[model samples]
Target: MTADEVFDDIVDDLAGRGVSAGKMFGARAIMLDGKAICCLKRAEFGVKLGAGSAAHEKALALPEAVLFDPAGKGRPFKDWVALPASQSEHWPTLAQAAVQAAH
Candidate 1:
């Protein structure tokens, strides 16, 4: 699926979760309350899990996940993870974790 399609699927999955869609960093983002749980940055999705949290550590351990470092080789958002397109199947679960973390 295309990036837009993937993002749509994610938003659809979160339909009853009380999250909302809005613009963030010039991209589409899923928000909980006023905080961003995840955001679509180009073709990739960035999930927030809070720095040093167990969920953050676990996500980082996944082979398909990486630290969300949009600024290239610089200080990365240690809590956020860039979910791999190859691992789209895991997005729902990761997205849930991000939502919970955002709360």
Candidate 2:
């Protein structure tokens, strides 16, 4: 499936589980309790899994994963990771972790 399709599936699944769809940085995002859990920018899946958490470390270790910097500046969001579509297989799992972290 294409990146957009994969992202849509993730959003649909999360929404079924009570997560709400919203916007973040002008990109599509999934929210929980008014807080963003994750966002999709181009083919990147930016997720908030909490800095220094096991899930965050694991995600960063993935190929092409990096700290999310929406503005393209040196500063990056400590709790967010930008995962490329090449790592899409891990998207669903990490997305769930983001939701759990938000709780």
**Which candidate tops TM-score?**
2
Task: Provide the clash count, candidate 1.
Answer: 0
- Evaluated at residue 9, the lDDT of candidate 2 is 89
Off by over 4 Å in 2: none
Per-prediction CA RMSD (Å): 1.6, 1.0
Q: Write the per-residue lDDT of candidate 1 for residues 7-101, one digit (tens) a residue.
A: 78878888688888887777889888877788888677889999899989988888878888765577778889987677677777888898788
Residue pair clashes in candidate 2: none
- Candidate 1: RMSD over Cα atoms? 1.6
Weakest 10 consecutive residues, lDDT, candidate 2?
Answer: 9-18
- For residues 8-98, could you state the per-residue lDDT of candidate 2 as single tens digits? 8888888867798899999888889888889888888999999999999999999999999877778889999998889999999999999
TM-score of each: 0.87, 0.94
Error of 1 at 57 (Å): 1.2
